[model samples]
Target chain A: MAINTEKNSYTVIFAVVMVVVVGLLLSGISQVLKPNIDANKRAEKQKNILYAMGVNENQGANDVVFVSDDILQEKFDTYITEQFYLQGGEKVDDPEAYLIDIKKEKKKAEDPSYDQKLPLFKGTKDGKDLYVMPVRGKGLWDAIWGFVAVDETMTIQGVFFDHKGETPGLGAEIKQRYFMDDFEGESFLDDGQFEGIAVAKGNNDPKNEDKSDNEVDALAGATITGDGLATMLRKDVQKYVPFFKSLQN
Target chain B: MGLLSRKDANLILDPLADNNPITIQVLGICSALAITAKLVPSVVMAVSVIFVLGVGNVIISLMRNIIPSKIRIIVQLIVVATLVIIVDQVLKAFSYELSKELSVFIGLIITNCIIMGRFEAFALGNGPWKSFLDGIGNALGYGLILVVVGFFRELFGSGTLFGIEIFGNPVEKSGLYAYGYENNGFMVLPPMALIVVGIIIWVQRSRNKDLIEEN
Candidate 1:
């Protein structure tokens, strides 16, 4: 005798069973793989932080360099010397800058104190010290983030930008070296004022004459995303001004 | 029919050419357009989809008889989604970069329409083994379109295939680059992917007379 599989009671029972099974299956898999996923994300973040400090993959025209898992960890340890958090011009007790995610922090609109803490990474290579600052903001469709590094003079040393869902070939160019290179050598302070870099749109050809002007040519077809990057970079950099200035004394 | 028999072989191979899920049925074209810009992600997406479709078909087919007809769609979806989530988690764990490149497209596989179509049209009515073959066939069909588009897109759009420079440096102005062979930037966009698919369908229809519609 075949069961009445199409009965309303059977349908409801099957639905409940499936929901429970799928939920358990997903949760189990996620739990088992959480450690590995977390490690991969941390490694990638370390790689980007390294990139912002000017440590790119082995340079060659056509050669692709593949760093093993151990070497990646070793490289991060060698280049980055210190990690700490700064809140209201004072160094906080948090030594783990890698644990804080600015993307998640940006979502808590109700938490006005969310911006109080900013993670700062100190990296050194070739006897030169660098401060790596993380910035994040909303792009055309999703989150855009990057590490902007500076030197003793507060000039932009290098940048490594990335985006989640920005339009490819347009706003996605931020990840490309050429776009990030525009920020190199650009100063953050304008005559002792904390003036951030300006991502100017449609002003591609000699936009400004002042050499000390903190301005860079924005992506041609990605004005809104460029503007978003500009705003976030300014806001994030401004938060650490007091801490950075305190180091001089 | 026996496994790998003449009839059974057609069940697996026909979709690759004459009856492709992407070209003939026009299913799962969104991912075909979205992830084909780079060969690595396209290949990964194909592998992920094949795994999901193949396992999903087998699981759904085995339970088809006991599944409540009123909730079959939900049942098929649960199986497909469970498999996709597994693939997503594994990708995140092992190959984070590719996972990032694929991003939301991997999660979007549940809505691809090809897997669900296979479940409703074939898996529900066929045995587990036959449904397994059919699922692999349709997925390979979809993979063919995606890989082909990815090859051309990466070649012309970036002067590279799988991130390897093929015809000298496209960015350099000196040496072999002065021939003015600039990368075709438009091929990287969504509209160009649709155009590439149209070209494939056009070539396919021309070769197979039965596929062409009467004028």
Candidate 2:
């Protein structure tokens, strides 16, 4: 109490000390959690990769044999045998797939002669080869991304989408399985042409669409997000078409 | 009287009823509306608020004398913000899914008003231990309303508590639900939360005449 409680000197010192203490404490906690957070994120991507490849939590390999959370890492390592990158209709071995930050690489897309190596994951399940690519786009509020899986013939097996800050109960439906299931069995191939899955603004049945094979029902009241999803899928998937076609022979 | 004085006990009890932060004082309603759509998130928010407010109150009270009145709010905010960040980190580490569900609300706890109100009104003038008690009182009061509203909302809206089906899977049990036992989808909306809290205020005020205004 000897220090005057009303002095500018006191306030400045207090502010500095408090900031240093809080900053150090938060940094320390974040440092301790860095490993686990990274692991969780990697595991989540692995899970999505498996999910996109058509592996279910409890319906893969025999009548049961579930791929629970603890086993997702192991399953991913086993199923996804190889990974590589492609740059402008050519296969390459320069960059790894999992490490590519789609959010950043997405920026290079604005450049016409974009030469960034795009990642492609290769896996096999039940004798069927799977090719997967990560896609990113802007949602209503923030970034939206997904893992898209397709077979050698350029048909979508399944997809796993998640968003950073889409409006809950409305635009956030993209993350739900019910909404994602709509993408199941849809193909990027339409009559021997590359056409990515389109998220329609209408919830009309897939059979009712003019291009039923390439369209899925959109979330009601979330047209922007649906359109964004379509744009994200189209632009990102095109990067992997060369690699996928290269493996067909 | 010892530390377990009637007055100190009243600090804990009174807010649970008469001076309730959510229903009575009408503070910290944003979280109540946002997180109450599910019972689990409401409980988590309640526990988090309790920890942050209680610890922040004690920190502020201990520093009350030295805290320049000019920068006390800043100081209080620092304490609350640090505690909230720690809670958020722990949730992310351990309760990852729950953390995802709570999302921005956990960070938003720094602005819950109830915590700041107690720091200014009680912690500034009281002993650290007393302020700690007052903080718990307010947290419990706020949490009580959140839990009640969450319980009702989740029960009727989702036909579940903490995601457990209580009405025997309302969607699939249609043959058994011949009498039309359907989940009230409207109860999940934000306005329904306001109505639930209003009903609580009505019931509490009806039982306690002191809550009624003279006007």
Write one digit per residue (lDDT tens) for candidate 1, span A72-141. 8788888889998876566865557867887665565348865556789998978999999998887787
Predicted structure with the largest lDDT when compared to the true one: 1
- Give the CA lDDT, 0 to 100, for residue A174 in model 2: 91
For model 2, the superposed segments whose C-alpha errors exceed 4 Å read A58-67, A88-96, A108-114, A202-213, B1-3, B174-179
Q: List the residue pairs that clash in candidate 1.
A: none
lDDT by residue (B1-215, candidate 1, tens digit) is 56488876887899999889999999999989999988998899899989999999999999989999887888888888889889989999998877888889999999999999999999999999899999999999999899999999888887789987787775555434677667788988888999999999999998888997688
Instruction: Record all residue pairs in model 2 with backbone atoms less than 3 Å apart, i.e. clashing.
Output: none
CAPRI band for model 2: acceptable
| DockQ of each candidate relative to the true complex | 0.74, 0.49
RMSD of 2: 3.2
Recovered fraction of real interface contacts per model: 0.89, 0.58
Model 2, span B1-215: residue lDDT tens:
57689999999988998789998889999999999999999999999999998998999899888888898888888888899989988888877767878989999999999999999999999999899999999999999899999999998898789977677655456433556777788899898999999999999889989889897
Superposed Cα deviation of residue A167, candidate 2 (Å): 1.4
Over A151-211, each residue of candidate 2 has an lDDT whose tens digit, in order, gives 8887777788888888877888897776776676778878767888778755457443343
Reference A-B contact fraction recovered by candidate 2: 0.58
lDDT of 1 at A154: 83
Candidate achieving the largest DockQ:
1
